[model samples]
Target: MGIGDAQVSAEDLETVTQQLGRTPRGTRAIASRCPSGHPNVVQTDPRLPDGTPFPTLYYLTCPKLNSLVSTLESGGLMKEQTERLATDEELAAAYLRAHESYLAERDAIESLGTQVTAGGMPGRVKCLHVHVAHALAKGPGVNPMGDEALALLKAQELWPAGDCAETAAG
Candidate 1:
């Protein structure tokens, strides 16, 4: 469809074309309006051009709504894009990976020192610090890796230190 057609709304054409294209690569091109006038998008997947499987449905603001959606999609793509939420299995797997890594590092540090205190091994501590910082820095958005990292950090009580904590806090 062309950009301009009084009978066809740009939003409708965009939605239908996206369904046919089977690619939701870009942000939603439509917005939703509630009874109270709250704008949002109700994502629905009709089918692909070849009738293949599609991703889950989700509502989002239109990219035309001041380019917010486009900005988010672009930023996410640049930063190893992630969804807003994680499944339980994903969360569990991330937690297990982080926990295993932390344990292995802790063991290595303990081996280096005859007596291991809370601050005995600065190397392992530093690693933990970095890991936690990385997780938290992923933003307040819901994510499996971030959640797992945060959980591991809290379990170990390896609070942030020095510039890392300052950066995370800021």
Candidate 2:
């Protein structure tokens, strides 16, 4: 995802803290917001302030989104997507590009010196959360599988609506 302005206010941090139920570390900016104007995807620093490596550059922080993704996982969407990847040459190429793009974005902040990208990218579909976060933050067309999952969510009428993230703050 594009980093955008990379601005994180104290209020924004507070909202994220509430959403995650913990202090967020190395939060670079709010990469994407839900339609209700709350952060859903956050752009994070590749490495934590304490020098611990954090490979996840874009984090999905909305509790509702998390719950929906978890449900999707339990429904075996990952396996379906992975199976499609094996046979869909166009999709496989896009997924590989997504992997490379993820690595490049993280490297721009700080080189982790590892090819490992989130959500079992490049060859496998592992975590819908990562892919969803990527698609949400970066928008459609960047990650093929992510786009597919998002389309599924839309079809199921499960796309997060309302200020669910703000509700966590309450």
Candidate 3:
């Protein structure tokens, strides 16, 4: 019932399973939560029990948030973000750091034997879900793209236009 804690409560596990519509694998910790205490982001192991390499260290587990993020992705946000990476040197550098940070975190758990980080990081914005999950898990100022995506979503209980946040929290 805590961030970075090894023990994940059965309730949280069950909630995540319901959110994903499948039994989750490699879940390690509850990375972040909605205002109502629902687990919105989960920290996972580098590899699954079946020996599958799962590079996603932070997994978004809220169905409502997932739907919103999917909406953003469908809106061609990924393409625009990727294009911005080519010109926004500062953003690109920060994204590379985010990628490195993700790799380090995953490596600390178990090396997947590849530097391939999640979310198409350091190069392109392939997945808004991953970036948003990363931002929620690590907090602000860590992932620039994530922060931007979060802003675009206006996803925070403190924000005025928190459609996703309200959906997840409520």
Candidate 4:
């Protein structure tokens, strides 16, 4: 199927949740953190006291080539193919790019940190680095684009240990 045509299904989401040992509610909760360590559940589009948007982790779920790769790798479809698919180089590169973008966004937010707020709550935004890492560490059920997205998310944070590369290599 063409890249854009692939879709992430409910089954895929269930698989990811099972693999990660996390519930959807937990995932959403993690996404709502502010820099000051306050949870943003009470505020819609909450900002930090310094005027930064609550740090958010975004994930675009879909089925695509990477999902195929993950399936093949999980099933031991081919030695050569698995080796190429499981390597760290490509993932590392993606992680770096994502990290750069996150840093830039953080800097921009910091510049406007004094103006962010929602209703009466003080803004406390911070980048959601771990969520991105989790996305990057997606296993066999996740599609290729999803994998790339995850890698970008992880790379943004200097390749955090215990996920993505670690799981893939293991």
lDDT scores in order: 0.33, 0.87, 0.84, 0.33
Candidate 3 lDDT over 15-66, as tens digits, reads 8998899999988899988766778899988889998889989898887778
lDDT of 1 by residue, 1-170 (tens): 11112243455555544534443432222323222222223332322345543231223322232132233334452133123122345544554454444344334423322222221121122122223222332323322343444454346544232322333224
Sort by TM-score, best first: what order? 2, 3, 4, 1
Q: Write the per-residue lDDT of candidate 2 for residues 63-98, one digit (tens) a residue.
A: 988998999999999999899888999989999999
Error of 3 at 6 (Å): 3.4
* Tens digit of per-residue lDDT, candidate 4, span 1-170: 11122343465346445544563321322222222222211111224444545543333222232343344345443333224434656643554444444344435534324332211111111222232223333332322333443454356543332232334223
Residue 83, model 4: lDDT of 42
User: Which runs of model 3 end up more than 4 angstroms from their true locations?
Assistant: 155-170
Pull out the clashing pairs in model 2. none
Which candidate, 2 or 3, would have the higher TM-score against the true structure? 2
- Candidate 4: regions farther than 4 A off: 1-47, 50-87, 111-170
TM-score per candidate:
0.24, 0.92, 0.89, 0.24
Q: Pick the lDDT winner.
A: 2
Looking at model 4, report the run of 10 residues with the lowest lDDT sum. Answer: 118-127
The clash count of every prediction, one per candidate, is: 1, 0, 0, 18
Could you tell me the lDDT of residue 105 within candidate 1? 39
| Strongest candidate by TM-score | 2
